[model samples]
Target: MELVKEIFQHLNGWGLTAILFIVGILEFSFGLYKKWKLNDKLVDLASILFGKLLMPVLVSYFALQLLPKVAPEYKEIFNWVPFWWGFFIICIADDLTQYWYHRLHHEIPWLWKFHRTHHSAPYMGMAMASRQGFFYTLLFPQTYVTTTLVFLGLGVPALIARGVKGLITMMAHSSIKWDKPFYDNKWLHPIAWVMERTISTPATHHAHHAAHDRDGIGHYNGNYGNMFFLWDVIFGTAKITRQYPEEYGLEEYQDDSWYSQVLYPLVKSDKPGSELAE
Candidate 1:
């Protein structure tokens, strides 16, 4: 456990950046770079700068400070629990919270405005993974859950689970389509079945980002899992087609500026019909 924590601590700063660059290069090499627009790049850059990097650090700092005052005695309460057990608890709590959080973002009108930026991208890639509204990132439920768990002495396992989740999310959003081969090969079908059920895969996640659902391949309302697909399965929101969508993004999208996309409601858009407009 100590070794895992040490390794993650060493790589934490550069890991996400490295993954983005690597997957971005692969997307470029495969000629999918043309699919990206200038606005898309700008939104993605803003999201990475604000949502992934700046906001998380700021939130974590506040969480750390505030948690102690609210419940100091609860600190490291789960430290004595077995490592695997702790990890299991985190997987269930963090992922399930995220599942509902994500589902609600689509089901509710006000919440959808904040989450709209994520699905605004016309294409899927490593960059789009970070394309979220600033406030949406700030109030992410999993962040609070994970932060509280860490305060309760589940730091090491929580970090490890976070690392694993990060990797899965990055791949799930990447244009590389890593899960395709598993569905294609006859012998790998068994492994693929288990994998698709166990975790979010490119096919399953892309379906969620699909612009429309009339095609049967796109499932914008379902497959709301983050780290684990089990939550979706158990909750009856799972959709697995082993197929990719022809198009992505919102069915009815407004051409809101990058600023409005990232900092909506706080920084309203000048566009007359935009949801972010006053």
Candidate 2:
């Protein structure tokens, strides 16, 4: 346990990159061999490259310049607290910021264009974490917030938050559906409901990836919560469909190469009806 705790201390900027790399590799391999979902592969690869490689570095650069002035008292606060309290604050703030950014992705057209790459995947797995568009992470508020926290002398806690959030979000998107067996047990409903309402579950997150508004749709526009579903309930965006999607991915997507998906937003394609063609 001591060594395990020490490894967590080493997880900062580059550490996050390494962690994401291992996760992306495991998910990609599973997605290719067992799940073998072609449409999802492009999305997985794009998200990893953009979210992991470009976004954090850019956010940290800007955050470092601002944090010294914005939250100079952070170290003082850190000094006063027990370590776990600081850790909890970073984790909660990180997720709260992510919840809004995620909700915005569904409502804003420009943001939707980027976020759709994630919804474009027909299947969910660990790789689903990597299903974002190139440059998409630049607009993510959570990335900025996490970076700011780090620069404010809450760096270790921010890393801890990232690791915890990653585990929750990735598990929620994983192909393994964990809710089914629990459902038939009458004893579990109250506990499950409380947990689901407070935090995200596979049932809720999978519903976001759903394709349409029909019974099969899983109510995609709602359930915009990240680690905590309560954010949705509090904000009036929560959807409570306990069912998973019969079908997934954008209803209108046509196959495009990885190049087009990554570059079109920046390059502006001429392809007819392309998302960026206009």
Candidate 3:
């Protein structure tokens, strides 16, 4: 267990980066890069640099500092638990919490402002996966939960689970459409049925990014699962279209500056009548 914790402390960030890089290559090869506008590129670049890379470190630092001071007795409380048990705990606690957190961002008006930047992109690809508002990235429930779990002595299994979740999330957002084959081939339909019910896939997640639900393929209000699709199914928010949306992003949008999108409220958009302007 000590060895596993040591390895994760060294490799967590690097492992995530390697996954992101590989997915980026696939996106580029598949021509998803052509769909990106200048603003999209700007937001993506900032998100990769700050949102995914810098923010996690800052959050972890603060969490580690604050947790010990506030709850010293709770530190390493779950260290004795077996790895598989810890992994299962994260899958339910972290993933299910994220599902509700994501769903609330759309259903609640105030939170939507923070999460809207993620849905601003007009395409589905790895680049848009991390295009989140600065505060949104920092305040994400999963981030706090995962960090807390590690502090509770589940570091090794938590890191492994996080890596698995990251891979699934990147694939779901990528333009590769890997799930399409399962939907297209009759022999593979059975696998799609089981897979879509278990974890998120490109088809299920892209529908959540659709501009509107009028297209019959879009389910903007549903399919909020980040890692596990089972949460959506259990909570009655699941939508399995087995198809991609014709368009992505909001039905109504303003040409807000990338700065405002990444660092909103701190840097309001100059565009008149924009959400960030307020």
**Candidate 2: clashing pairs of residues:** none
- lDDT order of candidates, top first: 3, 1, 2
Q: Write the per-residue lDDT of candidate 2 for residues 103-126, one digit (tens) a residue.
A: 787899877777766776766766
List the lowest-lDDT window of 10 residues for candidate 2. Answer: 11-20
Per-residue lDDT over 40-69 for candidate 1, one digit per residue giving the tens place of the 0 to 100 score: 788889988886568777767756788888
Worst 10 residues of 3 by lDDT: 3-12
Instruction: Candidate 1: give the clashing pairs.
Output: none
lDDT of model 1 at residue 128? Answer: 86
Q: Give the TM-score comparing model 1 with the true structure, all chains together.
A: 0.93
Stretches of candidate 2 above 4 Å error?
Answer: 1-40, 63-78, 269-271
| lDDT at 245, model 3 | 92
Structure candidate 3, residue pairs in collision: none
TM-score of each: 0.93, 0.80, 0.92
